[model samples]
Every structure is written in structure tokens, then in C-alpha cells.
Target: MRRTFKWGFIGVMVLIVGLFLDYTLPQHDVVRITDTYNRVTPLGSLNRLFYASPDAGTKPGTAAPDIRFIAAVRPNGKVIVYRNEDTGWIWPPFFKFNSSNLQAEASAMKSTADAPRWVMVTNYGWRIPFLSTYPNAIGIRAVSGPDVKVFPWLNIFILVVLALIVVFFWRMWVRFRERTLDPLIAGGQERWDRTEARAENAAADVKSWWRRIIRRGR
Candidate 1:
């Protein structure tokens, strides 16, 4: 039972970490730009975390910011929307500050369905229509065609570094248990044994004294 619980806890932790990395890491989408426009959208508590902050210098008001949007169509004829915004100095650490320039580039790349101009968009975040959250676009560039092979070197490097960090910490934890925690536990067990021995000796003495008094009374 203890082994099962330990394995279950580790599995849960691994799943949470995997999901966090999947959401935070940058991803690529190759699509044809259909349109680019700005909309005054109101952000609520539910979807606010997915969008950029007003302090990012992309939008001004907190209640309802004028958000720039890029609409694109995938090769399979499905549509996907991306929000253009600066990532500011914090969070995700994309350091994106040229949202306007990116909007312009996306606008220029806009093409019709007949003559599509494929582009690779590097972005992070998820688009949940139910919650009205859209993926934030970080960078965009023209590609040869819809099937252009785009290698994710940055993601590969980050994953490797993260794996190394996890391994290093795991080793540190094991060493700490062996060098520090195990010894403390052993010392505690020794102290407990001594305490039990003393308690037993005191009870034995009390019983002997009582017996002697009873004999004197008789």
C-alpha cells in the first residue's frame, strides 16, 4: 500500500509538471493569414490570465482593452485566431515589445484562399472558445509553403535543460536523505528505545516497593 501511494504521488507530480511545460513552452503553427484587425474586448477574471496585462504597453485600459487580432486559416481549411500583444518584462519571459510591428507584418502577409501565403507563427497559450481565450502570438515569418518543415530548436534546448535540472535536484534530495535525514531518524529511534527502558524500570521498582509494604502490614 505504501509503495502504491508513493508511485501514485510521483505520477501526479509528473503529470502536473508535464502540463505546465506544455502550456508555457512556445509552439509553432503554419497557416495562411486571412485578416488582421483590432477589437475592443472586455476581459473578465476567467480569461484574464491567458491575455496580456495592460502594463505590457500593448493595451491601455484594464476593463476593456483594444486587442489586435490575427485571423489565419490552416492548410486543412480550419480557422485559428491569435492575439497580438507584448509579453512585457515578466511572465513567460518572451520579452516581446513590438506588438504593433508584428501586427503590421501579419497584415502584409495577408492573402486570399486562392493564393495563400504560408507563414510560421511562433506562439504560446491555448485558445478556449468556451472561455473566450486566444493564443498569444510571439513571432511570425513567411515560409515557403504550408508544408514547410520548421524545427523547434528552442523548445528542444529548453526541454534538455529542464530534464537536467530535474535530475540534479533528484540526486540532491537522495543525498540529503542518506546523509542527513536517515541519521536523524536512527537517532530518534535510539532515544525512544532508551525512554521505554527507563519507563519499564520505574514500573518494576514501584511494584517491588508495594509488595514489601504489603508484607510488613501482614
Candidate 2:
């Protein structure tokens, strides 16, 4: 039972971390830009976490708002839609304020199915059809073709820095417990042991005194 609980707790932490990274880290998709347009997308409780802030690119006081979208076709003939919106100076900190400009660029790069012009779309987030949430595109660029190698040096560096930070704090915590908390615990145990010894000795002395009194009376 304890083992099961331990594994379950670790699994939960892993899942949370995975979702966080998947939402924050930028992913590159090579696809043909089919079209770009704006639509009034309705926000809901279930998928609100995946979209931009309520005030950003929103209808200014309504549940539904107009958002820019980039519709593209992958090399394998798969459709991928992206939401272009401002990150608005928070959270992942993309700080994008040019959703319209991005839409214009996407429109300019729109291509046909026969002779496809491949482009790389840089985005972050997941496409959940059930929740009507799409990946938010931050940037896009024209590529030579669909087969391009984009090495993620930025992601690698960010992950390395985060790992270092975790290690530094973890080591600091371990040293603190060993040097400060552990000694205090040991001292407390010693004091308790001394108190018990004194109590036993006092009881023994009281019993001897009582025996002496009994003998004298007899």
C-alpha cells in the first residue's frame, strides 16, 4: 500500500511537470500555410486555462471573443490549426502584442495544395479538439521545404538552467537539515534520556527511604 502511494505521488508530479513544459516550451511544426483568419471563439471553463487571458484579444466583456487563427496542412496531409494571440506580459512571458501582424504574415505565406510552400510555425500549447483549444502560434517563417532540421538550443539551455537551480536548492536543504536540524534532534533525545534516568533514580531512592522507615517502626 505504501509503495503504491509513493508511486502514485511521483506519477502525479511527473504529469504536472510534463503538462507545464508542454504548455510553456515552444514547438516547431513544418507545414503548408493554407489560410489565416479571425473568428469569435467561445471560451469555456474546461479550456480557459489553455487560451490567453480573458482581456487579451477578447470581446471586451463577453464570454466569446475574436481570435486570429492559422490553418495549415502538415506534410503527411494532416490539418493543424493554431491560435494567434498576445501573451500579455505574464506567465510564460512571451509578451506578444502583435497578433494582427502575425495574422498578416500567415496570410501572406498562404499556399496551395499542388505546389506547397513549406513554412515553420513556432508555437506553444496543445490542440485538444474536445475542449476546442489549439496551439498558440507566436512566430512563423518560410522554410526551404518540409524536411528541415531545427535544433532546439534554447529549450536545451532552459532545461539545463532549471536542473541546476533544482540541484542547488536540494543540496542546500540537505546540508541545512544535517548541520542544524539533525543536531537539535539529537540534543533533544539526549535531554529526554537524562530526564528518564533522573526519574528512575528518584523512585528508587523513595523506595529505599520507605523501607528504612518500615524497619524502624517494626
Candidate 3:
């Protein structure tokens, strides 16, 4: 039962970390821009957190009055949609505030099927259709072709730094337990064990004395 709980907790932690990374880490997609448009997105209780917070860029809203979107199609025949918004010095720290410019660029980059101009879109977040969530596009750049290689250097550096920070804190915690908490616990345990040993020895001595007296009487 203990092992099962330990594994279950670890699984939960892993899933949380995976989702966090998926939501925060920037991803690149090579695709041909199909269209750019805006719509009044209604924010329900479930999907509201996925959208930008009010005062981040849009007006104060539970339902965003206007939300920009970019539509694209990959070479492999999959359609991907990205929402453009200002993160505005909040969580994830993208600080993006140029949604209008991005929309214009996306509109300009729209291409035909025969003469497709593949562009790499830098974005973060998830597209959950059920909750009506879309990834936020932070950047766009023209690539040579659809097959251009895009390396995620920013993600690599951030992950490495985060790993180092975790290792540093973990080592500190282990050292603290060893130097402070462990010794206190060990000292208490040793005192208890000594007291038990003395009690056992005294009990045996009393038994021996009682037995000798009984033997004399016999």
C-alpha cells in the first residue's frame, strides 16, 4: 500500500510537471498561414483561465469581447489554430503586446496551396476544443521551406537552469536534515534505547535476587 501510494504520488507529480511544461514552453510549428481574424470569445468557468486575464491587454472580461486568431495548415494536412494576445508582464512572462502586428503579418503571409510559403510560428499553451482553448502565438518568422529545422535553445536553457535549481535546493534539504533534524532524532532514539536496556537489566537483577531467596528458603 505504501509503495502504491508513493508511485501514485510520483505519477501525479510527473503529470503536473508535463502539463506545466506543455503550457509554458514555446513550441514551433511550420505551416502555411490560411487566415487571420477576430471573434468575441465567451469565457466559461472551465476555459476562462486559459484565456488572457483582463487588464493584461483586453478589456475587463469574463467573456473576452475581442480575441484575435490565426489559422494555418501543416504540410501533413493538419489544421492548427493559434490565438494572439498580450501576456502583459504576468504569468509565463512572455510580455507579448503586439497581437495586432502579428495578425497583420499573418494576414500578409497567407499563401496558396500550390505556392505555399511555410512560416515557423512560435507559440505556447494548448488547444483544447472541448474547453475552447488555443495556443497563444508569440512570434512568427519566415523559414526557407516547410522542412526547415527549428531548434529549441530557449527551452533547453530554461530546463537546464531549472534542473540545477532543483538539485541545489534538494541538496540543501538533505544537508539540513543530516546536520540538524537527523542528529536530534538520533539522540532521542539513543536515549530511549539506553533507558530500555537499563530497565531490562534491573528487572533481571530483581528476578535473580528473588530466585536466590526462594532457593535459600527451599
Candidate 4:
């Protein structure tokens, strides 16, 4: 009964630990829009600067035009203007743009019937910064240069948790084997019982033989 209870408790603990590992050890790109804006107007070839391939070329509301504009609408009402620099427009180097403004701008653009409709720009569903590199990086969290950091601490955390789980299970197995199974196997009660029985039989045979000899002599 004790063994069964201990094993059952161990199994439950293992399952709980496994669940925690599965839940806390994975990294996902959590896309959260901070603000919403009226429109997103790209600066310079901001489309070419930020997005590439399929996203490059057309500006919202203009077809076959030389330059295009891009923007993002955030959850809260705000706007991020991404003007096409090739259109001969020079934008200020510094601006106060947030996620909410970009979101609102995207919503407004989508509602209007422009040639190139404005839509939320996402890659694999995460809201990325405007530029792939820095200096001209437009998005809220985007750094100005190509030196954005990828967090390794998350990976390190997962490794530590996994190591702890392995150690815990290993310790449990060692305790069960040494404290329970080892003593039971080495105590030798069966061998001692057999030796005592053999000695008693031998003593009885010797006494019986002696009695027979005495009777014969008499």
C-alpha cells in the first residue's frame, strides 16, 4: 500500500512537471498592437525599405505610381505616416509614432476605396518593425540599425527546467531502489531457515541410531 501510494504520487508529480515544462518552455511571437491610427504613410521607399518581394511596389491609392505609402493601425487610436521618399517628399528625421496610431491609419485606409488598399502588414502574424535594418527603422519597437537582439534567456530557462525535471525523476528512482528493494534482497532469511532445518534432521538421525545399538547390545 505504501509503495502504491508513493508511485501514484510520483506519477502525479511527473505529470504536473511535464505540463509546466510544456507550457512555460515554448516561445511564440505574441502580436499586440498598441495603438490605432487614421492611416500609415511610408517615408521614402519605406515599403522597399521595410517590406520586400510581394509587399514592395504598390502604394495605397496609387497604381503604377513611382512611389507608395505604407502605415499600420494600432489597437488604440493613433496614426503612423509612412510617406514614399521617391515621391519627392522629405519627412522629418524624428517623429512620435505609436502602435495605436498605425492601427487606426490601417483601418481608415481599408475602409476607403483606394487603388492599393491599406491593410495590416504582418509576417507570420507578428507585428514587425518597419525596417529590416536600423537608422531608418520606422515601427515602434524597431531599432534604427541592424543590431536588434534576440533574447537567449528564454532558451536558457527551458534548458534549466528540463535539467531539473530529469534530476528529480532520477533521484526518486534511486531512493526507491536503495531504500526498499536492496535490503529485501540482501537480508537472507530464506537461507538461514534452510540451514536450521538441516541441523535438526541430522541430530534426530544420530540419536535414533544410538538407541538401536543400545537395544541390540541389551
TM-score of each: 0.89, 0.84, 0.85, 0.26
Mind giving the per-residue lDDT tens digits that candidate 1 earns over 84-185? 988888788999888989999999999998888999999998889998888899999999989987788999999999999989999999999999999999
Sliding window of 10 residues with minimal summed lDDT for model 1: 53-62
Best by TM-score: 1
Worst 10 residues of 2 by lDDT: 54-63
Sort order, lDDT high to low: 1, 3, 2, 4
Candidate 2 lDDT over residue span 38-142, tens digit each:
889888889988888643555456548777899999999999999998888777888887888889999999999988999999999999899999999999899
Model 4 residue 45 lDDT score: 55
Candidate 3 structure lDDT = 0.90
lDDT of each: 0.90, 0.90, 0.90, 0.43
Between 1 and 4, whose lDDT is larger?
1
- Candidate 2: stretches off by over 4 Å: 1-8, 54-60, 192-218
Error of 2 at 111 (Å): 0.5
* Local error of candidate 3 at residue 143 (angstroms): 1.1
Collision pairs in model 1: none
Q: Per-residue lDDT for 1-218 in model 4, tens only?
A: 99999999999998997755543242322122222323233445543433221222334554332323344333333443342222112222123233344434434544322223223332211123544221121233332222334465765876788799889999999999899877776665666778788889999999999999999999
- What TM-score does candidate 4 get on C-alpha atoms? 0.26
In angstroms, the error of model 4 at 75 is 20
Tell me how far the alpha carbon of residue 174 in candidate 2 is from the true structure, in angstroms, after superposition: 1.3
Judged by whole-model lDDT over C-alpha atoms, candidate 2 comes out at 0.90
How far residue 27's Cα lies from its native spot in candidate 3, in Å, is 0.5
CA displacement after TM-score superposition, residue 8 of candidate 1 (Å):
3.0
